[model samples]
Target: MTQSPASPLPSPEERRRLREAASLTQAQVAARVGVSRETVRAWENGRTTPRGQRREAYAHLLASLAEETAEETAEETAEKSAQQSAQESTEETEAQNATGGRDMTVGQGARERADTAVRTAVPAADPTEVEAPPPEARAERPLSPAQAFDALYAFCAPALVRQTYLLTGRRELARESVERAFELAWQRWPEVACDPDPAGWVRATAYDFALSPWHRFRPRYRHPEPPPSNASDRALLNVLLELTPPQRRALLLYDGVGLDLPETAAETEATTPATANRLLNARAAVAARLPDLSDPTELHYRLVELASTERLRAAKPAVVRDGSERRARFWTRAAIAFTVALIGTTALTLRTAPTQYEPPVPPGETVLGVPPRVAPGPLSEKEQKLRAKLRAQMQHGPERLAPQPE
Candidate 1:
């Protein structure tokens, strides 16, 4: 015998049990079940019953509602753990900073000890939580602008900075560009927050800022005009200019940016090792022209030191504003006058000068007057002896030095 259609509805007790199990309010259930709260109330109060599919959907909605009590309990536990770890890390950093510059061995030892203590004291993620794909899942999660800003600053700030520097050799310029990008992000926080790659947007924005006219007007400190005889500084400048923006970026990203190979690839949207290798090759082509440094670190430090010493005052307001027009006009007139003078000089030289039949130049002779090579100054007896010893050592089959030169 088949039951009547009235018997297809759920009993009041069953509805109550399902709602309690699923942790849903009448409104929540009604919304999910395609009905009003009043309708749900009538069913729950046993004045009416949902029919057929409506009854099944109501049951399904109740079953799917989240159990709020369990979620809150887990969140509290996780929050406590996170707070404790953060406090420990902050303490550790402070202690390490306090020990700066006494004995290297002592400072290093102190840091190691602090780090070990924090590692031991901090609670590890629970086994169940650890086994879950939280890291993978987080990529899918949405973050508010403030939350994303905090996360990116803490984890990706260093990487982003290095990336910017890689793209632009000018440190101050790169920093300013990154600052502008962050400002833009802040202005459009709500829109940026919804983006799949907010960091990418910032990076692209930085790229644009670096190329802006205002950025060009930004003060770029360089060594004061060296004497004409100072060939080294001139050579360095030429080498620096030879590097294209992308090549410089590759070097900066690899060495200066502090990113591992894979991280750099991800940030730059390169495929794999091969792409990084191509970038490296491009950098090598430019670095090949630069003056050879006995120690690259020394060169880096010297450059940074020089940069720090230079006062980078803002450019003159008038010049930055509309002075370009006046300068352009002046240069245009000057150029025309100079060009006319040059033509007259060439005409006079060609027409008035008597040309004689010239003999072929000697093999040893230079067409342009060649400056004589300067003779080396006499070395002291001790210095001469040291040089001789080094030459002899080099001749004797690659003898290793007692100390590797820094």
Candidate 2:
């Protein structure tokens, strides 16, 4: 038996009319939905119907096209109205002038009536507020990348800066990375506008920029050597570094990027929650060795402190010549000099003392033929008193100071 001919699809004539009314070509429609020009022609010619998902998409596209067409017509009508009203107003003013301002009141009244009529028609004709948006019945135009960036910045910059700094560890570097990502988005605006999560793309781009060689080497210094024996924080930092690239990616997605599991999956190109779970588990295995991250509140306070300090540094007000500060510095220098002088004088005094020499006396020098041995004198009263005070003060501990003997 012969197969019956396929049920008729939308006619070429109908499709042509719709496309023409919408001011769209076949190629444009095909480009949007990832089809070829020939396929679009065949569908329009009723040779075949777009199957399954494509048919649904096509129907939606056609509806959108119809709405756009209606909106364009409305816009054209509004433009024509504006032009006509302006011409009439000019003509009326001329006529009033011709009447030598004698009918100025009457002419003004007529013009005011006309102006009111126009004002009432436009929803937001006031000079202060923005012009009223086109009716919602129209298809909304897609935003360009620059426009989207502006809107995103207004909504997200506060949170974004924190998030970025957490990931990149440098405010200036983060800003540069974000700006570069936006520049890339602007260059590929056509593709970017259709992306499901444009912000995610920017985040990824920033991550890549943060890892660039130039950024990695930006710090140039020989740090004082770390104390021997691993600190918990240093150990944890090492563990974090040991993680595989993918594990690091997942952790950052959820923890750093603040993405949920589903978003993490999307960013990592993994399918299923199970896969994402495995990735996260792997990351946790590495991270468990790390010191517990500080509390969020503490971190926030730290950021505030850092930002305020940086701002103060940047502002760098003049260093005032305050009496106390100056005195403290002068005293510090004086104390250092006094210490050096005391040390030098003590050394010189100790070195210059003569060595004691007992000359052996001849037999004639002995008194009453008896040799006299040198006898040691008892300690002086002042020395004995100072020693007693020091001993007492030592017994009493640090609370009391013993004054030196006058």
Candidate 3:
């Protein structure tokens, strides 16, 4: 009988995408599968492949997670579509009503005015005189704060997440950073809305979070899609990965995110000159690696598009239901309680402890005993001659051990 071919294992990229789509961090997935995080990372990086029971477990886990993720995505998409349809319907209704009312009022006034002008001008004017259109009904009113924030969130969140992903090279970390920044913005809407560059504030905050050391200990998730497999793109990504974090961040912010030198510098917390230098070095390094690319701008545009596409796929719409304030309050209360407990414990220990005491010395007596006085005997003749020689040496320079070179 012919042997059946064994089922092929999933590719590393497939595994990574499944893990991320399920929102499971490497550590979390590892724990579920009874493996170390490093092992999971190794599997994802193609350093090693799972086998036997481990392989079975990994496959099963991924299958379940992927299925769940698909279901969730479908549900979310359907809900979003329904909500969007409803919102559009409402907006269309409002627009029609407002337009109808405005047209009725404005059309009558414009017609009357135009007629009056035409009649007056017709008597003395040339036949070629053309009437100007009435000025556009006063420009649409400024957006309210809530409307402005919604607009900003829709425009800025995806790009911010993308820039952060380029900086950190991790999808979940980028998402977390961007989400945290938006949470802060939601909490301080007034301040954020009034800021000169509200998007800048959000981007800077996300960048800071992406660079935070806390991420070192936090579990990591992968991007849903693998990077481009083309030689030039691969070379560029490899060079970028090799660069220092500051250099990578500078390049991404300036080229990928389209931030200016000063803005990039501010986001990276470096001086403008330093940021410019980093960009120059990063570009030179990429060029050296991929000399086939004639135009450097092509690389920048490619990276920007890559990051933007990934972010657009990954970023969810920002909702203002963040519980950050509640978390902050809880931490604050916990700290206060801890401080009070520590203080009370210290006070109680002090109150219950024995007092230190010192014993008094007897009146007119030293605490330590004094040594008995002793009489010295006269020096022997040889000792006296030695002492005399020492005194002579002290009083006058000693004779040279060897004759002076004079």
Q: Top TM-score: which candidate number?
A: 3
Displacement of residue 325 (Cα, Å) in model 2 is 50
Q: Which scores greater on TM-score, model 2 or model 3?
A: 3
Once model 2 is optimally superposed onto the true structure by TM-score, how far is the C-alpha of residue 377 displaced, in angstroms?
Answer: 99
Model 3: per-residue lDDT, tens digit, 59-132? Answer: 88988977898888886776666556555555655565677855554555555555455444334556588676
CA shift at 32, candidate 1, in angstroms? 49
TM-score of model 3 relative to the true fold?
A: 0.48
| Ten-residue region with minimum lDDT total, candidate 3 | 313-322
Candidate ordering by TM-score (highest first): 3, 2, 1
Per candidate, the number of residue pairs that clash is 3, 0, 0
- lDDT by residue (1-406, candidate 1, tens digit) is 9964533445777776667655557767777888666567667768566777887787555444434445656767766775676566556666766877344565556567655655565556687766655453456757655566666545544445544543444556656666656666665667877775576677767766664545555355343233223465445444544666554444444444333455456555666575577556655664576535334454454334333333333222232223334555787899999999999999999998779877888677544787777788999999999999989888868956697679
**lDDT of each residue in 1-406, candidate 2, tens digit only:** 9954433334567666778787677779888756655467667766557766677677677767767878988977886796578569868877887978656777777678767756655555558775665674378898764567566544444444444444444556655555555556555656766775566676677667754656554563123223214354344434544665556556655554444455566566776565577555655564465324444333234334333332111110111113224555787899999999999999999899777877787675556866698788898999899999999989858875689998
User: Candidate 2 lDDT (Cα, whole model)?
Assistant: 0.59
TM agreement with the true structure for every prediction: 0.30, 0.32, 0.48
Count of clashing pairs, candidate 1: 3
Model 1 alpha-carbon miss at residue 335, Å: 44
Question: What TM-score number comes out for model 2?
Answer: 0.32
